[model samples]
Target: MLVALGQLAAAVVVAVGVAVVSLLAIARVEWPAFPSSSAR
Candidate 1:
């Protein structure tokens, strides 16, 4: 039971890490179109 729980925790951590990486990649791809804060 403890091993199963540990696996579940690891899976959740990996999922969150992937999500964050994906978001960062998307943001980097779209960054050029974003208006510069300094331009305001």
Candidate 2:
């Protein structure tokens, strides 16, 4: 039971970490595009 709970917690943490990393990566990719678009 305890192991199951621990695994669940780890999974949640990993999911959140992946989401945050993905969002940051997207933002990084789009950052330059925003400036160029505005400059147009």
Clashing pairs in 1: none
Per-residue error for 35 in candidate 2, Å, reads 11
The digit string of per-residue lDDT tens for model 1 on 1-40 reads 9999999999999999999999888667766566673246
Candidate 1 ranges beyond 4 A from true positions:
31-40
* Tens digit of per-residue lDDT, candidate 2, span 1-40: 9999999999999999999999888766777656874456
Judged by whole-model lDDT over C-alpha atoms, candidate 2 comes out at: 0.86
TM-score for all models, in order of appearance: 0.72, 0.72
**Global lDDT of each model?**
0.83, 0.86
Residue 12 in candidate 2, Cα distance off native in Å: 0.3
Q: Which candidate is the best by lDDT?
A: 2
